[model samples]
Target: MTDASLPARFERPSALAFLGYAAAIVIILWSFTGAGFSIDKVVSSPPRFADFLDRAFPPNLEPQVLARLGWKMLETLQIALAGAVIGITLSVPVALLAARGLIAPTWINQIVRTALGFIRAVPDIAWALVFVVAVGLGPFAGMLAIAIDTIGFCGRFFADDMEAADKGSSESLTATGARKLDVVACATIPAAMPAFISTSLFATEKAVRSSTILGLVGAGGIGIELKVGFDLFDYPTAMTVILMIAVVVISIEYLSGWARTKIIGVVR
Candidate 1:
């Protein structure tokens, strides 16, 4: 075959690409340095981990233990619900402001986006720690933490969905001399409702899991019990608690999926 007609063979990566790969590798190695992630350490830890696993195998299913776990699980769900409610309610205004086509004044949109970014920068656990200090421990702190975290994520996602909605309906509403709020309420919200519901459900599922961890810092939930079990070296109790959490999370996921189908209608 003619050289021009032949497919290229063994094309070399560019110098910049090679340098980028080297830099990435260096950064990864540097990160591990502080992490104390030697192969020897990893190998040595397996025996300790195996011993823990042996202890955890027979899960404690005592009635008192189960009852306490059930109550804590309910508290975790309550925290998640409260956070989801507050976060979704508070997100509406911010999301509306952040929607480009919905809201005017470029500076206002910039400010809203910046604030959302700032809120999203912190992890939920960090927020939980802060609120635990402020509120003096309990599900209140967990609720607040999840609310703040969800506001940042859900509001941004909702705003993006809103901006992508069909402008024709909103324009028609405006032509009829509908006020801005009326236009949004009548036109924009319906178009975005399915997406909004889906996002809220997903956020709620995440919040439920996060609420469990918030208890590590004194925010009330199953995490406190899990921490106690761990502290007391009661691996079986800890394993039971972990399994219960897994069950709850899986149940929530299944319910959310069903609800999403109902909200969005059956997908073909």
Candidate 2:
């Protein structure tokens, strides 16, 4: 085609493009407000961090210490697992309600999403504090706190996944004169199963980490043990606890990966 006959392309600068860049810079600066985030501060902190790291190495691996730490870590894992299971189970109905395609009423979806957002806004530590106050300190409080937090997170993600599913399957189920519950069970649930499982696993992994923190507030787990170690200025023991958490987290990540593959079938 001749140059003169070619379609003309717009040369105008995009207003939205400039605005987006400006907004990103503003956000980056705003995020650093209280950090004293200069290059000098960054350069100075490394040596201090290195000293701390040097102190953390050559971890204490005494058999007795390992035994106690292991028990506490197991307790934390149990609390996490229980919390995740309960949370994921409860999230299903709430997620369905929040899914727009599944629920025709805009107000209902809005209400459900708003509730989930509110739950998510408060951190698990805060929930742990509240539960600890009401329940008077235990793994029970930790479990409940994690469960509540997971419900918010998993429910929101699950709803989004469900809403994004193919509409044809759902419509087909409805056309078969199936009940709403039946259609959901057959169409929506199956379609979203892989995502739901993945979300649940992610929530479980997070709950495990959060459960450890909950113990700091007297909610019961390795966190309490960690606090004790810190209070006594036993950096070796604290490091051991931290290492245990790292191992557990890594193990859970592997297991979740395996489970995901099993559920979704091997991706080509």
Model 2 over residues 7-74: C-alpha lDDT tens digits?
66865658998899899999989888766678888889999988766876767799999999899898
lDDT measured at residue 42 in model 1 versus the true structure, 0 to 100: 85
Tell me the RMSD of model 2 versus the true structure. Answer: 2.8
Each model's total of backbone clashes: 0, 0
Which stretches of candidate 1 lie above 4 Å from their native place? 1-6, 9-11, 266-268
In terms of TM-score, the best-performing candidate is 1
Instruction: Tell me model 1's lDDT, rounded to 2 decimals.
Output: 0.90
Candidate 1 lDDT tens digits, 65-158: 9998999999999999999889989998889998886755778888899899999999999999999889888999999999999999888989
Report lDDT per candidate.
Answer: 0.90, 0.87
Determine which window of 10 residues in candidate 1 has minimal summed lDDT. Answer: 259-268
Candidate 2: TM-score?
A: 0.89
- The global Cα lDDT (0 to 1) of model 2 is 0.87
Estimated TM-score for each candidate: 0.91, 0.89
